[model samples]
Target: MKKIAITGATGFVGTNLEKYLKRSYKVRTLSVRYVHDQIFNITDDIIIHLAGKAHDLKKVSNPQEYYESNFELTKQLFDAFIVSKADVFIFMSTVKAVADKIDGVLTEEDLPNPQTHYGIAKRQAEEYILGKEISKEKRVFIIRPCMIHGPGNKGNLNLLYNVVKKRIPYPLAAFQNERSFLGIDNFNFMILKILENKNIASGVYNFADDEVLSTNELVQIISETLNKKNLSLAIPKSIINGIAKFGDLVKFPLNSETIQKLTENYRVSNQNIKNAIGVDKLPNTAQQGLEQTIKSFSKK
Candidate 1:
């Protein structure tokens, strides 16, 4: 079995991938709390750099937090990989590295024009990796995945689940936006496939689910999973904006940050990646992947 080393093993995607990869590969995972001893034993293996700082949702803090963890830390890890002579390198980059607000479907051709510091930092790290000339025999794959969702995810999904559990009426149902989200299962399958193939070129690839989903669809699915009626209001976006602004002034939950998240078009196209991989399409459809995720909420 091929040995695999992973950073951010305790995180959402890492833990999920670890569970699946243990079935076939010998896996070594790293944590900041641990020493180099955790990553030292695994030499000449495939390293999946899943560790990085995510975008700050609060919109209040220093931008350095992103660069320190995402760029600087990744540089440290990639340097170690170079000396170790790792066979393959897979870096978990984000679509945000390309744009803060994707006006239309985003493709690989777009030159990165990141908005926030988080995006800027990740883009810098990606450039650093791509600029380097590693061993001719080795392969490198940089993956820019859109909003990823699965059972163990602790981000937006958790908030949606809470809202459903509380039976709060979703107010911003009028906005129709298409957004792409990757299921963890499909991501795992794609990563494993990349590891198995040697002829695949070393370059950047965009990863996402088969189709885009709207917020209304998400709400309906969540309600179905919880076996409850969909309680949502298709109010005007302007009115909702007004309410969000008031909420922001009063220190309420539905502030500007939440409004932006709850209603934004971040649709991404994986056609370029599909063509590069010489594959027809994704392994699972968007509906299938999302249903599986919704069902998992009742597992615990």
Candidate 2:
């Protein structure tokens, strides 16, 4: 069996991916921390780099942390992979590397203009990886996955779940917006397909679920899962804007940035990846996967 080494194996996605891939491949967790001029000794046939500084919603993390963890660490690891025996190198990037807000459907064709340190750092690593010349024997892929959610993930979705669980009225229901999400199962499927097929080509691919859901729809789904009444209040958009501005003054969590995140059009196109993988549809639909995630939250 082929051996796979995964960084950030203890993270939400990493833990789920390890379990999913171990059934078919010899999987091992790799502990990687950023240090200058550090040498990585890798012998696995496949390497999935997942360790990186996540986006800080609370805005408390140091900006340099993103550069060191996302850019510097990846540069070092890719350098190691270039000389190592690894045939496949997969870097888990984010769609935010391209843009923080999209006016239309985000595609691979769009030029990158990242705003946050996290996105900027990831973009730097991507440029470095794509600039390098590689031998025909090896393949390199930089996957940009949008808001990924699953059973054990305690991301923004979890926060939303809690709000709905407590029967809080969703105040952003008035703003209609659509966003893409990546389920852990579909994410693992994509990774396995990339590892198994060499014809998929080595390049950047935007990964997301097939269906897009609005914030109100998501709230409804959570309410359905919890068997509670959907308390989505259709407050006026102007009032919400005023409240957000006031929040900025009061240092409330519902600031302009958070409100924008709650209501934004971030539709990602997974058509390129779907074509590359030769699949018309992923194994799990967006609703199905999200429902599963909601169910898991209920169990906890």
Name the best candidate (by TM-score): 2
Quality of model 2 by C-alpha lDDT: 0.93
Report the lDDT tens digits of candidate 2 across residue range 105-198: 9999999999999999999999999999988999999999999999977588976898899988888888999999989999999999998888
Q: Say which candidate scores most in lDDT.
A: 2
**Candidate 2 all-Cα RMSD:** 1.0
Least well predicted 10-residue stretch by lDDT in candidate 1 = 33-42
Model 1 C-alpha lDDT per residue in residues 107-155, reported as the tens digit of each score: 8888999988998999999999998889987888889999888875646
* lDDT of candidates 1 onward, in order: 0.83, 0.93
Question: Residue pairs in steric clash, candidate 2?
Answer: none
- lDDT value, residue 105 of candidate 2: 98
Query: How many residue pairs clash in each candidate at the backbone level?
Result: 0, 0
- Alpha-carbon RMSD, each predicted model: 2.7, 1.0
